[model samples]
Target: MTEPYHIDTSSNWRRQAVEDWLFGLDHLSPGMREKVVTAWVSAWASSSHERLEDMPFSPGENPYRLMDHVNDVTRAGLDLGARAAADWKVEFDPEVLVPILILHDVDKPLIYGREGNAGVHAQLFHELPHGVIGGMLLKELGFAHTIVSTVATHATNAPFHGRNLEAHVLHYADLFAADHAFRQMGKTPLYLRHGR
Candidate 1:
């Protein structure tokens, strides 16, 4: 397998982290392991198309660009989730976690618009929450209820009642990836660098 794409590739630390998680998977039952791997492969393959127009881009931006961003965020979340799950000893079905990580941001393209900035992508669209949309998509694609539920609620930040450890990990991982990408592009928010 090719190295997974990440927004921060300056070092190999993330790769090592994922490897460590893979090693821990050996403790899972064979059936469970197979299910997780299958979900991972299916998610990756379904979302792998490089053309943005093929995705559900909004009005102005190239679909390809949007797809690239989605890919970056999704990969970041998956990597972080794996690392966090391993570190926390969270015993989740990898099948659920892996697909949830991959599909958490699937709503971005559908919400894209020319007017607003990135921060409002979720708010601007007003579709079902991205998490909810993700869950629905996963279900449409034949994923189980557990995977759908996890993906749909990953972003519940209000009461925090809707998230599990894996979902929270995915959310934070996405934030980290987005921050890193923006910084690399010289678009890092002022508050992030200087604590405004």
Candidate 2:
């Protein structure tokens, strides 16, 4: 059976969130897998943010929580990677891709401010950006170089992207997820939405 790429949150979304992340990390070797799990838990515990719902889908949109955005991207990326391999004969390292998927947008809370329930990116981010911030944070937490590189470059259309196939996959995957979030919001008129 094929694993799902998208999650529709139930009442127990938090436990389901853990399961979703673990699914992405399942491709890693045992040691690295343990390390990722440890860091993920540590980051969540140590983070100043209270809940994923506080973070917006983007600096401009809040159709969903930051958690929703990351989960969507991870699922999309994994599915895209699989299709790329089977349909096009292009292959990427799943070990490399999974960590990148998990960490790619994890810095939304750190790089943006919580004004109520929305993520408003700081002025610094217009220059330095979340990909850079997220990369630095993950590296300090003791991630490998490839994962760092991939996370740091995964921003859509950022300069560091397109440097390699892994980066390309991540960049496009982010776009796909962001588009998904925006479309969800698009169901209602923008004026009716809370965020402008």
Candidate 3:
């Protein structure tokens, strides 16, 4: 395990996972980093509890924190996407794809939060999955339209016109990361274990 990040300000403990993940991205511009961090900060602020931002999708299912899962996906997605894209001669841009991977699950906190030992989850993202909510928040936070669309469609099963290729990359990348994270903990993800 890595040592905790040392934030210089008083509001240190809040959203440390998100901050640690964001600070690791040196490829992003200062403005972009700020925007990404701000999106998470806004999510945390919108909630009542402090730990909601770190909550996993389901304690019984997911084996890692939501932020950790997102990080793992992003970390794996970049390399995997690039390699796969290169082999297929597909155009893959990191600037466009990285943000989508990082922010794909930004709404997980809004969806599943452990409110005082109760199964308290948000219904605001009921009809609209976390991808749509996170995409909206990302757009309002000044991300590009393509980025928002990829994030939105990542969780949506149906296909749509004007959808960017990175959307599929992100969608599968998330699946790969989820399965890997679960397997790391000696658990099968979505029952993908061979022979059950």
In the range 1-196, model 2's lDDT, one tens digit per residue, is 1210112123354444454545466677876665555544444433445654565666654657777777788888898888888988988887778888877875665556567655686544566666776677667767878888788877754575547666767777777777667777765433345744
Which stretch of 10 consecutive residues in model 3 shows the poorest summed lDDT? 1-10
Alpha-carbon runs more than 4 Å astray in model 2: 1-23, 42-46, 122-127, 187-196
Model 3 misses residue 80 by how many Å?
A: 1.5
Residue 139 in candidate 3 has what lDDT? Answer: 76
Model 1 Cα lDDT, one tens digit per residue, 73-183: 556656776676689876656555655555565545444433432222423246455566555545655667766776666663423424567667666766665565555
Give Cα distance to truth, residue 7, candidate 1, Å. Answer: 30
Score every model by TM-score: 0.52, 0.73, 0.75
TM-score-superior candidate, 1 or 2:
2
Ranking by lDDT, best first?
3, 2, 1
lDDT of 2: 0.65
CA shift at 133, candidate 3, in angstroms?
Answer: 0.8
- lDDT (Cα, 0-100) at 77 in candidate 2: 85
The list of candidate 3 runs beyond 4 A from truth reads 1-17, 59-62, 115-120, 156-163, 181-188, 191-196
Better of 1 and 3 by lDDT: 3
> Which residues of candidate 1, in runs, are more than 4 Å off?
1-50, 53-64, 78-82, 113-124, 156-161, 184-196
